[model samples]
Target: MRKPLPFGISVFVALMLLASQAFAAPKSDLWPMWNQSNEANAASFDHQKWQQILDKYVVVKGQHNLFNYSAVTPSDKALLDQYIVDLTSLDPRNYSKDEQFAYWVNLYNALTVQLILDEYPVKSITKLGGFLSFGPWDDDVTRIAGKKLTLNDIEHRILRPIWNDERIHYAVNCASLGCPNLAQTAFTGENTEELLNEAAKQFTNSDKGAKIDGNTLTLSSIYEWYGVDFGNNEQAVLKAIDVFRDGQKLEGWSGKIKYDYDWDLNQP
Candidate 1:
């Protein structure tokens, strides 16, 4: 008969294994910028269901992108503020690389929407400047998991790192009419592929964004913001735009219309 292993050793090994698994998984889904499930307008909370989704992804405590935040959503602004524990208070040393990225992206979006809600009736986010002389979008006042984070931190640091893919720009929205309509579902790494594709297709194809009038082109200014993301150069970007332009020739598509941004919160 073999002697039983020491309790301390056994517990240590078990904990180590558990920790490994946590890092192996990613946190959250890769849904579009504005994702609300069925009854999205309701903005109801389903803790069990939400945990199930987050469980599939890795969780890095205290880790943040450039911004101190690690997750944010239109509805989350209230939930996190009122209920969810501070995620950024956790330790970053324990988080995996992908886990950190996931956390930061979510945080940025969450805080942004929250900022808008803070001043819901405003005509534009640009009007939110204060003594800081900048919008909350430029604020570095939150934490992710357990690390300090800011809005820019999420966009340039993490999201840009993992997918260096420009289409992502179209996927991550800023809660403005000029931005893509937010999806009503969560964004998980599992469905990131479909999410990105759909966003690109949706924005480029919609006449609301870019349309062709017998060669006269009307394009969303997004074609101008981080335009390089659409292509290596403007020409390359135009090529990507053409995919959603309904086979219209870019040469003759020359319709000019002033671009507009809806400042209202993307809600029902």
Candidate 2:
């Protein structure tokens, strides 16, 4: 026979569930990028607050979005425009090594976000191009840490070698609504590990990379797009994802994955 539960135990169980519902702070919500979410929209990041923060921190530049964690709503094209202006005005050359790294990562992500915002509400990023293109990833006008660089530069030159982390490809979203939700915060030097891991987990756990359906696994194009980085082929990519995923095994996954893309603005 089972013993009866104590009165205090019963109350404690109820409290535990209620406490969980109250929502604990997410270890990973501090973004090194931007996203348009209802929660982010509610914030009113004041310009004054940012100026003050810059005065105190090692921020490489004084461009917009550097201190604009206000959680504004919708995250329209106008915000991206202002941020680009601010980003270009910043001078990473004046900063220290670590400070410059942080600045470039942010600069790459910020300009990309604005590109999407400029073509808001579109279905496919390709539509914005003149003839045949996947969008602005090929464009040269994108800025990074106050310098004019292409999306390719930010990815291949800065993020790849210095960081040696392909996971960043997933972090610096292109802002197509179909892209992973724009991160709600900026990536700061202080919380680099926390934010990067969070992004990897979110992208892998979601349909973007790995999905569960009893025994079968459905994957995202990211695996294929960067397969060379993962390994010579698909198996290597699955292995990388497996390292981050818990419980869920790669049992039968061989990188023979499905592909899906959303041309949306990733907007709310």
Candidate 3:
């Protein structure tokens, strides 16, 4: 038979046991209430307003899609504000999976543009403020279906986890040159897949996306940061890239990869 331990020893052991139990428990899914099975309601979420705004402000300069931030007219700003209001008024759960995906992606991109406009003349999006002044990603920028959400919440909690599609990285733009080009038009449920494919193909072919210099295969840091999403390894990332490249092979590929990123605002 074992004797009872001292009070301090007993307390320490109990704390350790509790800690282990806590660590073993699975984390709860954040968007557990999001209705994934709902079929798309025919009630279209109008993106015409967003399309107008994009057409008026975004321009294709050389290879980059640059927004004329300084040229945004008062009317365009009003249109953007109204678009956000219209978006937040909808109940996303009523929409289909594809619709919801488009909704979130559009909302993220629009809000990002808004952030830049709100603080125009800034060199980079990373300079915006949020919790602890780290960035604007954590700021509670909007509400959908009565739940307030930050940009990070929309991206990580909802979009990334729900869709589980690597191509999503292309769909949602970061308003930076290093990030995938912001689509010139608004994303609608009808065009989400096509738009995603186009964005991926365009980016993969761009010098900013991938470049071969001698023996080195340089890629966007996006692949370095989210390689798991592309495929969990370097070779897997190359495979995904090749898919968009239409089976084009990189000869003399030394199996070496380098990552680069440009934080300059995609501006004109």
**Candidate that scores best on lDDT:** 3
Q: What is the lDDT of residue 134 in candidate 1?
A: 32
- How far off is residue 178 in model 1, in Å? 0.8
Q: What does candidate 2's lDDT look like per residue over 1-268, in tens digits?
A: 9997899998888767764453121112222332112322222222332223324321222111122223333533355556556656755444444444455566676665455445555554555654434466657775544345676666665566555676776667665433444444565555567767876776666665567666456766656666666666666777788767764767457444465555444433
- The alpha-carbon deviation from the true structure for residue 155 of candidate 1, after best TM-score superposition, in angstroms, is 0.6
Residue 167's lDDT in candidate 3: 89
Question: In candidate 1, what residue range of length 10 has the lowest lDDT sum?
Answer: 60-69
| lDDT for each candidate structure | 0.50, 0.53, 0.80
Looking at candidate 3, what is the lDDT of residue 54?
Answer: 87
Give the distance in Å from residue 258's predicted Cα in candidate 2 to where it truly belongs: 2.9
Candidate 2 residue 19 C-alpha distance from true site, Å: 50
